[model samples]
Target: WFISYALDEYFYFGIFYGMILVFSFYNLIMFIAIRQKQYLYYVLYNLSVGFFEMSTDGIAYQYLWPNAPEWNQVAYAFALCATSIFALLFTRELLFVKAKAPRLNQLIIGVIVIRLIFFIYCYLFNQTLFSFKFIEAIPLSVAFFTGIYIYKNGYQPARFFVLGYSFLFAGFTLKFLIMLGISWLNFGVVSYYSLSFCFVLEMVFLSFAIGDKVRLLKLKKDKAQQKIIKQMAINAKLKDTVNQELETKVEERTREVYHKSLIIESKNQALEEANSLLQKQAEEISRMNVLLEQDNEELQTSVEKVSRDRVMNTEVDFEEFSKIYPDKESCYGFLAELKWSKGYHCRKCNNDHYFSGHILHSRRCSKCGYEESVTTYTIFHNTRIPINKAFYMIFLIYSSKGKISSHKLSELLSIRQSTCWTFGSRIKKVMDERKKTLKKTGKNGWS
Candidate 1:
């Protein structure tokens, strides 16, 4: 019997230490992952409980059981009460109801303190304030209710707690039944196995629950990220549409401006041509006026010669008179001269002379009645200004050198500044036309 009991004690110690190591490792892993104060507290409490169970079992049953050693009983009782107090503290903190039900938690704390004090007093004074049966049963009942409360409240660790406590309660009940000779099995060893198995099961359940919670949290986070990505894609598409619309509007506006520019260019070309024609007419009129002035000077000289010859008592010089008149018929001789110079021969009369006008200063053809004024085909036709004024305007433009102010030109010409500016602009247009024509001719030559 002694050898069997010794073997049982050794086996129980091995199993108990193995369970302690496993729980310690599990607690360390949980602490690393969660880093919660409540989990640390639970780990400390479980370690204390493991220590109390191992020590009490070693002393009470293994060392002094059947002999009832005095010191062993005191040690056993102390370990038991300490383990109960730690368990109570750990449960209260786990529930996190210390704030909501402060008085209840404080009452439990008070009870543990009072129980500790009484246990110490009994150890020192050799008195017992409470029976062992009452002490053990009361704490067990409190543990059972606490486990049920945690489970009902949907605490994640509650399933482990409930399962573990249920196993412990059943083991204790079986031990009591054995003590009363109501069972044939060795309830003490069975209780140790039951408690260890339940602890391992509880740890497994706790690990699964924690893993599930973490996975759910990750899933929710991923869903939120996907939602944000979808919204961003929608925004990007909207931005692309807006940019395309803006580009289309820009292209439309550019086309409109191009059409308007073409219209403006056409109008500008028409105005430029009109100005060039006016400038050419003014230049021709100036040339014709200069020729008329020269002819008048020659006539005055001839008249003076005639007067001198008369004073000298000489007969009228017929040669000089004929030279002066030159057959008034040939006074318009220049009209035929200009037509013949053009190399035009009349087919109806078979001679260029037939196409020429016979009447003095007449532009009408003697043969065919075809007529044209000397200035008709020239640039001087239909001019409004006097020839001298046009010549003066051109001279002022060339003499001003650069960027001549219209106001200065108006003062010099004794004309309105508005009229001077108009004339100046018309002259610039003619100059531009000549430049454009020269450029076109140059390009044609190059081609």
Candidate 2:
């Protein structure tokens, strides 16, 4: 009978302790992977429970402390103290009780300090009091209550935390009853390892709690990224609408310029007919010829001045300026022509062959696959302002002889005062560099 009982005891204790070690090792690896302190504390708590089980079963005395018989009396007490402390620490970190429930967090800290003081007193004065392991019910109950309170306040992860603690709470309650002289409730083998079973259940659920928290945080991050993408799409649509409106204005201006040319051509034809008819009246035709020549000269000079002024003049209204640039497409078209008018050559490989690039009015080298935007080397590179607006701002600053205030420029461009000032200052510096050229080249110097 003694031999048979020893075999059963070894088998059951071996299996239970093996499971505890496995849980401890697995959580230690989790702590390494995530660097979360809660996992480390959980591993410690599991090891404490395993140690307490070993000491109570006399396995620690036989295997761990074989030379020291005196430690067997208080070994379980030390293990219980570690278990309660580590469990409280794990609860504090896992549930974020500090942030959610500051008062409850302080209470948990106080409980830990009191539990330590009692353990020290018991260690120094009377080690026999260490057998009253039911005192653990206090710290365990504190952890359980904190989980419930945090879960009630809408912390989703706390649901699993509370569930995990409920099992441990039940196991502790049963042990507390057994300590209160309820011998009939202890059902042999099942009752002996009930707490071990509860520890495993709690370990599994606490893992679920950590996973649930990570999932919730990922969902929130994804939502914020989606909002940013949607706003970018809306901004692109607004820019396209502005381009379309500018294109419509350009079409209207083209029609007006064509009509004016047709009127000038008809007047020239009328003058030729009059010259032919009055040829016999030489004096009269001579005087008429001089007058006609003067009128034509005045009209031609006026037309040239107006066209050039609108292109590079402060006096030119924004409405007139839109006819020249009109839209981002038109601005990009001008930049593309100016940048690569000579020939297409790869800056990276010096290859001449290329393809149209992903960006509008950009080119990509076929050899090196190096793509270059039209504005890459220009002043407009990396600028967030619309290309057309940047062009208009430049013309305004140049025509105003760098005298325009940032506030006035901001009002006209419908841009921020700081932005206008920054861009305007850069334009002034460029104008200063080309001041001599500007005098010789007139309005075309901007190009």
Candidate 3:
């Protein structure tokens, strides 16, 4: 029965140590991958738990059971103290509460230091510093209350921390109860297994928390990218609208400028036409003046020749003849002859055969009884002024080249400025009407 129990003990120890070695390597790799201080703390915590489990297992069952080793009690006491410190550090790191309370950390450190000093003194003097059994359970109580405080504070990671510490505290509590003569299960086996199982579950929970944190970070990154893409799309649409509006404005301005250009071109064309008409009238007036000058010179020469012939009596008779005759009939006949160089035709009958009836200074055409006058279709028609006066008005208008002011023309013509202005306006209106009529006729293929 003793050998069987020894073998069972060895097998359990092997299993526990094997698990610790495997978990240690796993946590070490995780620590490297994560690189966060929290993960590092977990790695240290796991290592410490493994060390305590392996050491206490050896001391409690293998080294001190049946027959105690030489320094069994002293070694176990030192191991217990070390284990308490490790538990305090692990719980503090896991809960994230130690950073908020500096005093707690100082108190824990002070307790560990005092315990260490007492433990060393006891080992050297062979005299205990307060009883070993009495202080051995103190770390358990401290761990339990710490776990409760962490849980009450709503620390999420504290759940695993509290559970791991609870397993350890229960293990120690059972041992304490058993030492005080309490009859229960085997404390050694139960404590080791419970502590190991709790550690495994704690590691699993920590891995899940780290993964959750990573997933949340990724989600936040994706949301930021989506927001940026949405903003870029909105900016692109605004730019397109602004560009289109600018293009529309440019097109409108270009059209307005083109319209103004066309208006200017029309005005230029009208001015060119008026200038051409003035130039032609000027040339006609110059030719008419030249002809009048030649006729006047010829008359002066004829009179001088008659005076040189010494015909005083004939000169007097010629003067009396000029006075009596005045040659108004001859002038009228000459004008008629010039006007009807083409044979006269009766307008009503549309016939070339026509009779001329002399009535003093005028001639009447007798064919369908339609009377004809030499000046009827000419510029001299229906004028109350002398022919010379009418001719002078035409000459003045032609000489001024269409630039003469109406007031200036009235003064030159010895007519009221209002009458001159009215006549000039009427003439301009008639010219415009004729031009429009000619343009319409040309469009219709008429001469």
Candidate 4:
């Protein structure tokens, strides 16, 4: 196979194998660093696919095992079996087929087991047992369909898987057609170079698929954490609000209680003071009542003394006044005695003779024919108050110790204050004149 191909082609194949080795070893290290099963599956899938391509293209025969040409006969078949097993396992892990696509997972397992059995049979029997072309097509096709199904169901990483498998499927179909002597699709490019290019694309696409899966997982985790943090913030704010409201309510209640307590204390103080004042007032009222009773006894004794002192004079109490001046005629008779203490005499003729006038309570002089009234030349002359009231006023004036106000005099006499003032002033003026005359005439000319 090397004798037919050019030296440039060998160089190209070497570079392609170097790339595959780099991808394989890098992913294997990633599996060790991260300890993820998907990384391990990717590493194994890359190694098995690269080995199958090399064995089919006669590269392994020339460089890897030159001394054992007989090994070439079964190398491609064994590599194919290994490739199928790892590819299916990687697909199962990548798409989460065991959980999400269980039927697909079972089908892949069955294919892997059947291929392993066939590989073992080929190894033991030393025969080219069955055509390995359809066996090779089965796993690639299943992986492609699985990518489509999972991608349709919204798996974001499956698009890369589908694209990577499409390239591998194309390579496998072309190689199969060439083995059956259909070489028109090769179109001047060697089948091995085409297969190498397709293998490189498959590796890149599969690596992107794994990277995409990681990115999506990280995005989901970050979103869930953000949601939890936001919820915690909301709860904390609600707690703060509740605490603030509780504090405000507490302050209000405290103020209200304090105000009410002040009002109650003031009221209690006022009530206590009022009770003390009432007790003092009760004691003072009791003393005043005793004094009032003593005053009444003294007033009665003074009245009896004044009555006894009036033995030679006319008494002016109610009984004495009624006996002396029971009617108008008796009142005139008393006024006549006070007016003229001496015998009646004529004013013009100086004759000491009198006769009764035709009018009642009037006297006429017979010597000069002059008439006179019993009230003439007395304070009762021209009085608007009744004669009885005039006598009472005179008695009250003489008995009172202090000067009485007109209001008190009017209240006692049951007369108007104006009338009491007029009568009292007139009587006081008359008594003052009489006192002056007595001083000048030695009290003898008053009569």
The number of the candidate with the highest lDDT is: 2
Q: TM per model?
A: 0.42, 0.57, 0.43, 0.55
lDDT of 4 by residue, 1-447 (tens): 666667877677778878878988988888887778888877877787778778877778888998887778778777778778888999999889898889999998998888888889878884567455666788788888999999999998999999998997888788778777886776766564666788889999999999999899999878766765676687688667766765675567557556655754565566567876666655555565566556556755755554444332423455545444445655776777766677877777888888987555677898777888877677888889877777767666655522667787788668999999999888767766776888887763212
Q: Would you give me the overall lDDT of model 1?
A: 0.57
Angstrom error of the Cα, residue 53, model 1: value is 1.5
CA error at residue 73 for candidate 4, angstroms: 3.6
Error of 1 at 197 (Å): 5.7
Superior candidate under TM-score, 1 versus 3: 3
lDDT per residue for candidate 1 within 284-336, as digits (tens), equals 54565566556556655655554443333233233332332233233234444
Q: lDDT, candidate 4, residue 165?
A: 86
The sequence of per-residue lDDT tens digits that candidate 3 reaches over residues 239-331 is: 677667656755675575566557545655665677766666555545655665565566556545544333222223323333322344444
Candidate 2 lands at a TM-score of 0.57
Give the winner by TM-score. Answer: 2
Whose lDDT is higher: candidate 3's or candidate 4's? Answer: 4
**How much does each candidate deviate from the true structure in C-alpha RMSD?**
44.6, 12.2, 48.0, 57.5
Residue range with the least summed lDDT across 10 consecutive positions in model 2: 305-314
Model 3 clash pairs are: none
Query: lDDT value for candidate 4?
Result: 0.76
